[model samples]
Target: MGSTSSGRSTGARDRDGEGRARNARPRDGLGRPLPYEAQGVARQPEGIVRTPEQSVAEAQGLLDAGRPFHAHEVFEDAWKSGPQEERELWRGLAQVAVGLTHAARGNVTGGARLLRRGAGGVEQWAAQSGRQRPYGMDLVGLVAWGRGLADDVEAGGGTVDAQARAPRLRGQVP
Candidate 1:
């Protein structure tokens, strides 16, 4: 209910005001708002900043190195930070990693289910994002391969053939 010098009731103080919200924290050294600043900045948590393509590249490296679990963790981190519109793609990638981990552990049924779920996620992303085409070489591709392997297993077939053809899940590119 306080009025500013211009005779306007300023519900909140501006940056120059010493009587600003007590909970407000100072700006950081970079002249940006501090991490805990409660006011003067929108509270929306920033999403992971890296592009999905970058995530894919990193995940591929992990796959090449035979580190499905690590790749899954990366995808999960990306998925959490990706925009809402692209969250599914990251999740799909992570799911595929999980599927691969299960396969490596000899949990065929679990792997199959995870792969199918990943495929569904990527397929949905494709429909929503309108990328290359049906099962393009991206999240969609990862998911499609997972689904294919899952289906192969369900049909009493050796899914290793599909795994062999699947894009590398991780590796350190020399």
Candidate 2:
């Protein structure tokens, strides 16, 4: 199911320690690569500007299912099509999703960087603007989760257990 731009197999012949076929690079639990070309996250349907309410539900569902790449697409739609005033909020959420995607693929360094970057944006907005519950969701918790995951990956000497180490994207109603 995975292939590179050149139509070559994405290292499916490679096997992990468990003898399970794995992609050459990092992969999801199922062995799909990062930026997995998920149909869900590729683009938003035309004329669809999802509300924060919609985004919270949609993104949360994807994240919980271990489909962070799909979740990123949902957040990307919000960043691209949602209200201008909430662009930063959506963008930060998207970054968090992408960071999670990176972690899922076992890219600890890249994942940690992105997780911190995304968390900072969301945390900064809350800290500076006094909007503790932007988008009626718990930004503080989400940001902390990202930071915690980043910290774990960063401190790991090498070889992060991404699936086991993944942090939940808690979506609470504010």
Candidate 3:
């Protein structure tokens, strides 16, 4: 509903300063617009903190369901709400999920790059947190998983196979 303030509607559509449609909206992969209540969506929830164990478990469940993007949401929540010390770990995990999402969407080059970056971040997380397995996560295993995906992407010549597989989200890397 864009108006020129002269009791006239902007014909057909209106472009914003960036040349995007003024009324353009965000939608999920399935092409559904965000819910009415979530239109001006906030990136993270406020005042909702979960234990590290809980956060990891929830992310894993989402990943298991072939929804890495959703898993990224859980990881991002943990990054935002959990202790500062564990923030990097959560952020790294979220990055991995996002990388997987990109691969699922056929952005192999971007996905490979992000996956490698995330894997490195987890290693940094391990060093900074002074725990090889903080929050009971198998950091090494997760790192390997990300790297493996990146390697697979590269081996495929930067284009992911349509049936490319995603890593599992459960158990230790071993």
Q: Compose the digit string of candidate 3's lDDT tens values, residues 43-156.
A: 323235788788878767666656677678788888888878878888888888888877766687888888898889988988876877776677887889899988887787
Q: After superposition, how far is residue 44 of candidate 1 from its true place, in Å?
A: 27
lDDT of 2: 0.70
Query: Candidate 3: minimum summed lDDT over ten consecutive residues — where?
Result: 37-46
Model 2 per-residue lDDT tens digits across residues 1-174: 788885767655766678977544444442355554443223323335677788787777766666676677788888898777777887888888788777766688888889899999888867767886765677888898899888877787354444454445455435
lDDT for model 1? 0.61
lDDT of 3: 0.70
Against the reference, the lDDT scores of all candidates come to 0.61, 0.70, 0.70
- The order of the candidates by TM-score, greatest first, is 3, 2, 1
Report model 3's TM-score to 2 decimal places. 0.69
Clashing pairs in 3: none
Best by TM-score: 3
Better of 1 and 3 by lDDT: 3
lDDT of 2 at 10: 65
